[model samples]
Target: MNNIPFYLAAFLVVLGVLIVVHELGHYLAARFCGVKVLRFSVGFGRMLWKKRLGQDRTEWAISIFPLGGYVKMLDEREGKVAEEEVHRAFNRQSVGKRSIIVAAGPLANFALAILIYWGVFMHGSEELLPMLGAPPNGTPAAMAAVGNGELVRSLDGQPVATWDDLRWMILQKAVDHESVVLEVVNERDEISIRRLYLSAAGEQGWEGDALERLGIRFYRPEMPPVIGKVVANGVAERAGLQNGDRVLALAGKEISSWYDLVTIIRDSASRPLRIEFERQGEVLSVDVVPDAVLERGQTVGKIGVAVAPGPKPAREVKAFVRYGIIEAAGRALEETWDKSVFSLVMMGKMLTGEVSWKNLSGPVTIADYAGQSARLGLDYYLKFMALVSISLGVLNLLPIPVLDGGHLLYHMIEVVRRRPLSERAMEIGQQVGMSILFALMAFAFFNDLTRLFNG
Candidate 1:
C-alpha cells in the first residue's frame, strides 16, 4: 500500500540475517561448551520452513510479526530432562562458559558491523568534503566568521579530512571559548588564516538548524544533468523524458548543472514549467508539473526521476572499503567495543534527561527509516542495519532481568555469594525485568505515535 516493497524486503532481509548471526553465536558457543541447543530460529511464532541437522533443529519461518527473534537452549530450570541430558543443560555449565555463551550474541552483532563498515571502506563510500559552504545569514557559523569556499582543515588542531569527521569532532568537543582556525586558499593560490571563538551560547542558539549553518556542504563538481532512469507512469515518463536526455534549461531559465535544475524545480512547487533538454543531439522542450512532497518538516517538489552519474570534483575525500574475512573479524571486534561505549553513554544521557526522550523510536519509526534508506541504495540499507544491530546488541546487554546482562548479573552474584539466587528471588527479578521492558516499549511507541501525529 505504501509502494515501499523494496524497503520492506530489504529491512526484513537485513534484520533476519542479523538475527541469524546473533543466534548462531549463542548456538555455537553452547555446543562448544557442551550445552545442547534445542532450537535455532530466525523469527518467532509458527514455522514456515524447518530442518533438523544431526542433533540440532534449525527453523526458517515467517513469523506473524518480524520485529525480533530468539534462540532457545536446553535448560534444566525450564523442565525435567533425562539423567544423561542433565549434564548438557545450560544451567549445569560453568560460570565462565555460560558467560561466554551469553556474550557471544552481542559480539556477533559487533562482528557484522565491522564487516559492513570494512566493505563500505573497501568499496569507497561517498563522503562530503570538509569545505565550509556559505552559511545562512545570522546562523552560528556565519557569526563565527565562517564563509563560503573556506576549507576547514581542523577542529582544535585535530585534522579533519571529511565533513563527517569535522562534525563529529565539534559535537564531542567542549564548546567553551574553543578557538576554531580556518585555512583558506583563494583562486590565485593565496593562503590566509582566520580564527574564530566558539561559545556554548552561540551553539545552543543555532540548535535545530541545518548542517549548512554549522559550515558544511558537499563539494559537487559542475555537470550537466543526464537522465538515468525514467520512472514508468511517473511525471517524467508521461512527459516523454527518456534516459540519457541532457537537461538544458527550465522555465526559460538557462541551467548549467543538476544543482540549478534542482533549485528551480524545488522552488516551482507543483507549478507547470517548460523543460528544455537535448536528446541524441536534437534539442526539445516539454511542459512538466513538479509534484510537491513533504520531507523532514520541509515541502519540496519532485519529478520522480534519477540523474545519471557525473564527474566528481577533485577533492580528497575519506573512503572506506569492504573488509576481508580476517580484517573484518578484527575490525568487528574494535567496532563492537566502540559502539558498546557509545550506547552506554547515550543511555546515561537519556536517563539523566540530558537528551530528549523523543529520540526513542519503536517499530514504526524503524520501518519508516528502513524504507527511506532502502530507497536510497543497498549501501545505505547496510549502514542502517549495522547501526541497528549495534543498538540491539547494546540494549540486550543492559543489566535488566530476563536479558543477557541480567542473567550475567545473577551469575556474578551467585559467584560472589557462593550460592545461586533463590527461585522466589529469580521470579521477582523476572517480573521487574518484564515491567521495565514493557514501560520502555510503551514509551518508544508513544514517541513514534507523537511523531506520526505531529507530521
Candidate 2:
C-alpha cells in the first residue's frame, strides 16, 4: 500500500518510454519514405496535449490511453488530401515504401530492445552461480541422484557459468528432449554426470517455473546472524542495534543463522521481541517491535537490517557477469532474436491448445511486473523493459488484422497480385481482426483479475 505511488510512477515511465519508441519508429519511417505524417501521437483516444512541429507542422500529441500510439500519415483513405500534397500522401506511395513504413514500428521496438540489452550486458552485475540443493523426493533431480550443494558445470556439454545460463539451457532442451545430461561438482570436490529426465516435468508448453518443476533449487548458504547495515530510524536502529551486532537469540529462541533470525522475525510481526546480541565482546539485550507490512497479501515482519556477507566458500556463490562491447552487442542481438522466436512459438502453441491462455497478460499484469522489476533494481528494471519491448515487437508483427503485420500482409498480397484489395474486402478483414483482438484482450484481462483475487 505504501509503495502504490512508486509503482504507478514506474508503470507510467515504462509505458511512456516504450510507446514513444514504438511510435517514433513509424514516424521516422514515414518521413524517410516521403509520406507526409499529419500527427505523431504518444497515445490514443482523448487528446491531453498537442503541438505543431517541424516544417510539416505535424500535430504531436499526448493522449489519454497509454497502451498504444500512432503515426497518422496524410492518406486519401482517411481524409481529404490537398491536390498539391497528394503526391506525398501515404496512399500514393509504392507497395515497397508502404510495407517499409508499416514494418518500421515493430523493427524499431526490436532495435530498442537490442540497444538496451547491449548496454546492460556490458554494464554487468553480480549473478548467482548454478548450485543445486536437495531435491524433493519423487522429482527428476532426486531420481537422478542430484546431490545438495552440487554446482552445475555444464548442460549437454555446454558450459554453464551462471544460474541464468543453466536455466536457459535447460529450458531450451526441455522443449525438445526428454532428458538432459548435467556435469556437476559436489561440495566434496567430487565431480559426476547426471542425466535428468524432463518428460515427467510437465513443462512442454513452458508452464510455471520449469526449473522448479524439475526440482532444481538454489543452494542457500548459512550465514551467521550479524547485521551488516541498519536502516535509519527503523526498529533495529531504534533498539540500538548497529552494524557488526551478532544476534545471539530472539524471543528466548536460539538464532544460529541469518535464516533463523528471518524466520523468527517474519512470524512475529507487530510483536515485541527480546533480542539478545553481542556488540564486540559485550553481550546485551533489547526489546524491539518488528514492523508489520503486507506482501503478496500476507503480513510479514521487517526489522530493516541487511545481512552480513557469508563466510569463505559461500562468497563464491556469486559471479560478476560482464562482457566486452563487441561480445555484448552480439549477445544482445542473439538474446533479442531468441526471445522473439520463443514468443512466436508460444503464441503458436497457444493457438494449437498446447499452451494455456492463462499465460496471456494484460496491462494490469504488465504494470504489476513493471513495479516489481523497478523495485528489484535498475538492471532488473532495464531487462524487464527489454523483454517487454521484444514482446511488443513480436505482438505487432503477428499477422492479424488491424496490426502492423496485417498491413504488411496486405502489402505482400498487393505485391503478388499487383493491386490493392477492394475497400469492402479490407473492411470485412478489419471487422474480423478487431473481434479476435477484443476476445484476446478480454481473456487476458480476466486472467489478470483472477490472479489478483486468487493471490
Candidate 3:
C-alpha cells in the first residue's frame, strides 16, 4: 500500500505464521487429550489449499482471509458424533482437558513472543542514542539553561541512554511544567548540572498536563556523523551513500557531530554541497544537492540519510545460553506474565478515559508497522513480531464469549456446578460474544480507515 509493495506480503507471512503456531497448539493439545481435531485451518471462509495429515485425518487448510484461524474439533454440541467416536468428542472430554486445549492457543502466542524477543536482544537491535542536535528557536530546552554539546544523562533521575528513552520521558513529562535537572558531561571531563523548567503556556505542551507537572524537553543526542539509512530514490541514495559511512565535512566545513551535518544540509537546500565522508576507513568526497520537502506547512531541505548511533566492532550474532531448562522455563513464564500485565494496564487506562481511544489500531496499522520494521532490518522485524505476538495473546485472553478466556470462564462455572452450561445459555453467550467482538473490530477498522483517508 503506501509505496511498499512487499508490506502486504510481509504482513500476510507474519499473520500466517502466528496463526499456524496458535492453531498447532490447539491441535496438538486436542490430540494429546484424546480428542480428534477435525479441521486445522489458518484463516476463515473458502479454502485456498487443503490437505489431510496424520492418522486423525485432520484437514490442514489455508483459507481466504488471514485475520484469524481455528481448530474445529469433533464435538457433539455442534453436531451428532458417531457412536464409536463419541468418547473422543470435544464436549465429552474432561473439564481439565478442555481447559488445556483452550488455553494452549494463547500460551503458544506467548511462547512465540518470548522467543522472538530473546532473539532480538541477543542479536542486537538498532537504537538511536541521544546525540545533541540544534534546538528550535524559542523552545523550552533551548531557552531554559540547556546548551549545545551537553550530553543528557537522565530525566527525572532515570538514565537516558538512548534517543527513544529521551523521547518517551520528554513527551510523557513535558506537559507538567516540571523542573528537570540535566546532568551534563563535556569532552574535558567537566560535569555540570543545569535545571530547566518547561513553560506550561507554550504550544509545545506535554502529555496529560492536567494530571501531573513534569517539565522536560527532548534533545537530539550529539552523535558522530554516521550514515544509518539511505532512502530509495532520495538524495543520499542518488549520491551513492551507503550505511556505515561517516560524514567528515559538508561544504568544506568540518563536520564533527550529526547536528553539524544536519544544519549544513538544511541551510543548503536546492544548492550543490560538497561532502567529505569515510567509508570502510577510506575517505571520499561527493557533491550532494538537498531537495525541498513540505512538512507541517514548512519547506525543509531533505537529505534522505538517517543519522546512526556510534559504531560498534563487528561481531557474530550468538544465541543466549540458558542456565538450565527449569531456569529458561521460569524466565519465559515471568516474561510472558510481565508483558500480559503491562498490556492489561495499558488497556485499562484506555478504557478508563485516561488514554485516548484514538490510539487504538487494527490490522492495517499493524501491517504498516510490520512493514516499517521489516524495512528497518531483521532485528527490528523480530522485535515488532514479538510485540505483536504479545498483543495478540493479551487480546485473545480477554474475557469475551468467543475467546479462550470466555471458554475458561464457562469451564470454571461448570466445575463449580458439576455440570456443563445449557445449550441455550451457551448459544446466547456466543451471540453476545459475537456482538462485542464485531463491535470492537468495527471500531478498529474505522480507526485504520480514518488514518488512511486523513493521510
lDDT of prediction 2 = 0.88
Best model per lDDT: 2
Residue 228, model 1: lDDT of 86
TM-score of each: 0.74, 0.83, 0.68
Task: Quote the lDDT for 231 in model 1.
Answer: 84
Instruction: In angstroms, give how far residue 272 of model 2 lies from its true place.
Output: 18
lDDT of 1 at 452: 71
Worst 10 residues of 1 by lDDT: 201-210
Instruction: Please write out the lDDT profile of model 3 over residues 1-455, one tens digit for every residue.
Output: 24356778778778988888888889889999999989999999999999998988889898998899999999987898999999999999999999999999988999898887555544444565554444545555556555554566776687766554555455445434465666766545467776656444223221233212322333444588999888999998898999999999888899888877887887776899988999997999889889975432234687899988664422211223323555545645655676677678667767766556666788888878777778878866776787788888888888889999899999999999999999899899999999999988999889888876664
Point to the candidate with the largest TM-score. Answer: 2
Alpha-carbon local distance difference test for all models: 0.72, 0.88, 0.74
**By descending TM-score, how would the candidates be arranged?**
2, 1, 3
What is the lDDT, from 0 to 100, of the residue 9 in candidate 3? 73
Model 3 bad stretches (over 4 Å):
130-337
Pairs that clash in candidate 3: 130-221, 131-220, 131-221, 131-222, 132-221, 132-222, 175-206, 176-213, 176-214, 178-215
Estimate the lDDT of model 3. 0.74
Comparison by TM-score, 1 against 2, better one: 2
